[model samples]
Target: MASNRPAPQAPFAPDASEPFAYGAPRAEDGVWEEWNPTEESLPAVRGRHRVAKQRGGGLARSSTVLGVGVIAAVGAGGMASANTGKPPVSIALPDLPSVDSLIDGHHHTETPAASLSGVATATATAVGDSTADAGEALRSRIMAQAERQQSKADSRATAAAVAKADQQAAEAAAKAAKEASVKAAAAKEKAEADAEKKAEQARLAALAKQYTLPTSSYTITSTFGQAGSMWSSGYHTGLDFAAPTGTLIKAIHSGTITEAGWAGAYGYRTILTLDDGTELWFCHQSSISVSAGQKVSTGEVIGRVGATGNVTGPHLHLEVHPGGQPTGIDPGAWLRGKGLTP
Candidate 1:
């Protein structure tokens, strides 16, 4: 309602007949003179005065204070932008109160510095929460991968152990089989040997019933092929049975007497020829009970034992010749072939 410009001063009027000059007045200097003021003649004010509305309605603010408020607002906006990685947000300042409102004290306003501080705090809190969540997710993934690796390692170890056990079992089975085979082969060989011995015994029993020895109760004095100076040949060629004089000599098997006579060194002798053309000779006998060309049965009395003709004591000399040959074979072996031990 009041003007800010100052009232114009009344225009100055000079007194009649008084001259005005630009020079210095004389020393008396008692007269007063009026002059008009111009724009150039005004004294310069040092700085600007800006009016601001305060609670009391009228106050003056300096330009320096306004500049500081603006700088603080801008710095706060820049800090928020940098932290959030976005463009700076524009802030709208509240309208200044009208002159009537200020005079009546009816309007209120919030400071710009306080508003910016609240915005920055909220943004920082949101960023921190996001970072914490991401870290938790990464830790979970790492733990899962480690667990999978451990499981695979355990499975591999188990498989190796099973394979080793299987191999050992196979080796043991092979060894047992080899030992069983050796035992079976040995058992088979022993069984075969026993069977062969039993068969040989049976054959000897059958032959014993078909033949008899030449004289009973006699001892063997000499075997076939003995060496002695009393024999006409260099080596004796007969089996000798030593006995008391007149001991009976039997026919070894069923045979026919071919000769019954006294031979030179033999003294008394008898020759019996078998059906198979094998000749049996009884020599050095005390007496001959069989005649030439006589048929004698098995175990029949043929002669008596004597110490006759190139003999040292009483003994029966027996010879064997196949097909009436002059040279004789071993009589002991020939009798054994017929199942006769003597």
Candidate 2:
């Protein structure tokens, strides 16, 4: 039979470096702003694919020529059968040759020409050549695409690693700054607390030296505001210390003597005035050492206890007044308030 068939299709060719520009703003300094797509502005592609088709001129022409050769041989066989009285013989053909070797200058040949078997073999060989060429081209393109994809994946992984390292360095710097600030504030607070504690201790020490007891050997025989038959006003308004004659009397605090002379019914009197106008009077003195307007220190000898004025025995009479007003209070309690023992 005469063979007639169309040529096989070729493989598709893909463009490797096609430029796809997304929608982004153009800047004046040759910089493009990134475009971020929202759900409303995003584009979708459905069932999109790159289709390729191949065409062949050589395979189609060769197949047609081989078919004519086969028809001529078969017609010659039928004419010979009528001329001779011999019986007609049938034959089988082998497989076709590879298309790659044929294209590269390697042609194939079979023996026993001018027979139906040889003609059929040549026709099948032409069709097989076209199909094999198409398949080889497709395989080459697929292998090239796989290599490009692998290279892109490696580049993306390297970029991600560099970005992560930069982020970690920034975080470490921020944490160090925060710790330094906290340490500085704590140091300042500690300095202020130490200074305040030192000031309080100094104030207490100064108060202890400013006050002291008048005399440690004397006893209180009469207190302020005493009510007895010994007074014409029915109440004693001054404190009295009863001791032996010529007992040494000392100044209670630092002050100036404002009056040191004889007074009626009180014998020799010595009046001392403090800085704030409080006056202390010591009476019934056998002798007075401080003169008027003389400054005296604490524990200094001021007078000697005696039995002068309206008294039954030798004793020292003391009186305290604020601004010279006779508002008598317990002298023992007053001395204690100044951190002194009476």
Candidate 3:
């Protein structure tokens, strides 16, 4: 629609080289009007300069809002990158869904320019939420790792204690076994000693019943191996018992009388031969009661004491010849070994 308004044009420099200029505006019928500056219009000029700021806070405020929007967009981009596993861009502008549509589960068809403010707010909130969630997950993982390490340490300590106890128990068992073995050995040794003592006593008891003495009512006159001038050998080889002239002299053991005759020096000597081939001689007897080849029992009278054959008085000489050899052993020691005290 055409109206009676002015057409705006470039300012005209009235003088060619002058810095002063003025607007050349034409009405619809093509008429020019004069314009000039004055102190009276100074307030009007200042008002014209502030017109855009009064309308919408001017370019500075718009730049501040745009900067805040850009910051919000970058934060939202970081959150989106974390959520979607993508890299973030250096400058990002957000495309936000409307809160109303999201709350109602409905789609809002909006123009990009119309929804910019709401998208920036939602992007900041999403960035904050994602950061909080990641912090919480990291804290949980660290706490779990600490708990597992503590459990492993506790298990190692418990195992060490158990192993120590087992080693001590094994050592104790070994010590007890050693002590028991020592005690058992001592007991066995003692038992063997007692058994040996009892066996010796039993042997002596049986031997006491089998032997007898050579004479009765007699006093020991001479010991064996005594140096004397009356003896033919260098030492007297027989034990002598001084008795009455007619005293009875008994056989020392069960034996056969091998000889009952006069010997030149040991007159009226009688020899008794035992089953084990040992010979006993009873000499200087007043009279012989047993004949040769006669078997005589122990304690039976075999001869009488006489003062004959290299004797100072009436005495019986007793000699022992082991294995029927001619060499005589000491008779007093042999008699005492058969349980006789003399």
Candidate 4:
């Protein structure tokens, strides 16, 4: 490379009398002749010269520059090797001034080590910042994913809780509805029973106005169809009312007296024939108050109870015969059919 330093001045030449001095002209064989030095006449100097000069600090400055260049090159190579994962690259340094030029007071400009170091520092800083940014982004993504998972778990728990609550509410409502239904059915059944009982009472009241008992203060001593030897038939075919002698007997219903007189085994008997042709016979009476062909209203006095013929005590025997049949029917059942109990 071309150097920016000024050319060095030549040294002073000695007189011809000086014996063979360098770069000085000398007379040959004592004959006085003029001589001049040329570029071809000087021999070439080899290698770096270590000569010190008074004007410039020679070897010390060169050593300093050399050390700085070597350090700069090592830094650049090491950085390049580390980044590329390869062998260090060779770095070409700027040519430095030789010792001869330095001793001649010639200076050369060199590249600064600070500039290379600055470039390396800037590149490393950029790589470090990039790595930091990447790590931050990854951490942010992980945190966001964790939050989403937690939110999903919470939603599931809430849904389960709501469903359970709804089920409980539904069950409670169903139970309440079932209970209400049962209560309504029971109320309906009770109301129907009460209404039927009231109707029966009303019917009995109406029948009471149409019929009356045969006698008062009497006890049922015998029922009809009772088997005994005391009766003419194999079974008793009449109802017997036991009472004190002379107790008054009343007509069971509005009827006409068909017969009233003393009978062979029935003592004083009275036969009352209803308008429907049903006959009610009152036997074993102490006295008869109605005569044949006489019309009597219900509850009218008819006869008195007595222990007459074939009687066990003071009782009035009664028989019912529909359409004047020869065989009699049960008198107690016949009385109940008229809304009366015997």
Candidate 5:
């Protein structure tokens, strides 16, 4: 039954719980314009993302909220219930939409349904493959660099060893050469000394072979400086050999006969000139076998002994004059120096 007891009074202003906003009223000239809001003439209040209208335009907002709720449910694998009085509802999930449709800002009547997980999995696999390849390349470069450094180190070591070996070898060779040179010098000096000694011995042996005695056999008579009345000088001035009247008198050494003739108070005198200009005088000879300026060898007969000079008996007088001087050294000592005994 309808009760007509006085219907509830209609409120003059809009409901307070409803979303309401006001637009700035337009002004004509300087005065505030009169506001007249009809059914189709109300101004819309707007922000960057939305416009709020009055009366019939408010229903469009409710429908847009319903559409957004339907999209959210599909993204969450929609759960809704068909049973009345149930707290939760059950609904089938729709596939995810394409990325272009989600960001286009222009609405589309239909969006392609695809598996997002498949695309994500493929992209992740590709990223992993690229990362692994980059890592391997970096590792290869490091290994190559390390190998190069090691090779350089090895080369340096080998070169150092080779240089050391070469230096040692050179030193050894130099040492060997020095020793050989020293030995050669020593050998040369010793050989020279031996040759000099042998030459000296050979010279001495030849010199000994060239000397001879004045006479083969004879006896000393009156010696030199013996005091007596021998005519001219009161003392004997020469050595005397007491021999037979015809005893052979040979040359004592090789020389040239300088004077071989009769001299005053002497029968036949012979003066032999030696190599050093010393004179050997043979006086009181019975006969002379050599002439002046004649060469005579050692042991060659040059005269015969006789009592021709001032002598006490038949003997040969002999005098030695050095450098043709009138004085002489002892003949016995001179003959001994020549490796002979008189």
Candidate 6:
């Protein structure tokens, strides 16, 4: 029974390593908890401890500020080195070709076939685009040239048409002028011809007023101044104008009335005595227009012829005397001297 009894009284002494005993109660909390932690177990609960409220909060904030300061310092150092134009800090070529080893190797004589192939492809593309651009430029130039040529041709045609029209107009005007001149000349000639014809008609009328004849168609049947026993004066002294009965008779000269009556030997007689005392006897008249003492003038129809006297046929016995003598001279020569043929 004595061996089985629990012993009591271990003195209360603090251990350096172990701050709290496993079964002892803490003085401040009355709970059994470990105060000191081990190195291996420290990582698990390094941030779990607490102090005073203000001190712990300041300590946590100071740790966060230190971490930010460290990161800013490293960024500032890198920027300063870059601005100073320094080389890279580390060189780790992952994909770049090692030109150094190739230069140290054997002299490799070969064509740059791969590089040439790339250059050729690029040059061919450039040449193809250049050709297409040149072709477009040439076509544009050709179209412009053609337009210019067409414009020139149209101008020439217009000029030619204008010239031709001018020539035609000139020709028409000249023709009209020539025709007018010809018409003027023809009108002047016709006027001259008409003047000449009128002058000739005036001359013929003046001549008709001067000469006279008794009958239109007559013959000299007997003559005056013949020594024969044929007249009452024992000689032929009158000119006989033998014509058909009823033939027209005219006065030989302008005179006044003497006798217009029938005589025995001179049938149907008309005697006209002129102002100069020359007596003209007209016989063998069919009628008489004047009385025995009626006055007469030139061209007066005094009598007409008839066979009422001692005549064998129808005739006009005419006699001209100087002073109304019974016998007359040759009247043919006398009338011919006064611009009359009969």
**lDDT leader:** 4
| TM-scores of the models, in the order given | 0.52, 0.39, 0.46, 0.51, 0.39, 0.37
- The candidate with the higher TM-score, 1 or 2, is 1
Candidate 2: worst 10 consecutive residues by lDDT?
Answer: 17-26
lDDT of each: 0.75, 0.68, 0.76, 0.78, 0.69, 0.65
lDDT of 3 by residue, 10-30 (tens): 454455443233234436547
Error of 4 at 52 (Å): 33
Q: State how far residue 43 of model 3 sits from its true place (Å).
A: 30
Better of 1 and 6 by lDDT: 1
Q: Which candidate is the best by TM-score?
A: 1
Error of 2 at 105 (Å): 99
lDDT minimum window of 10 residues, candidate 5: 78-87
For candidate 5, write residues 45-133 as lDDT tens digits: 46675543333323344335544665554333312221121222233335544333444323433422232333333443444455556
Tens digit of per-residue lDDT, candidate 4, span 239-275: 8888999999999899899999989889999999999
| Candidate 4 local distance difference test against the native | 0.78
**Cα shift from native, residue 29, model 6 (Å):** 99
- State the lDDT at 285 in candidate 2: 86
Which candidate order results from sorting by TM-score in descending order? 1, 4, 3, 2, 5, 6
Could you give candidate 1's per-residue lDDT for residues 6-47 as a string of tens digits? 888854544545544234444577685666666579675556
Which residue pairs collide, candidate 2?
A: 10-54
Candidate 1 local lDDT, residue 236: 86
Estimate the TM-score for candidate 6.
0.37
Sliding window of 10 residues with minimal summed lDDT for model 6: 88-97
**Model 6 CA deviation exceeding 4 Å by range:** 1-208, 227-229
Better of 4 and 6 by lDDT: 4
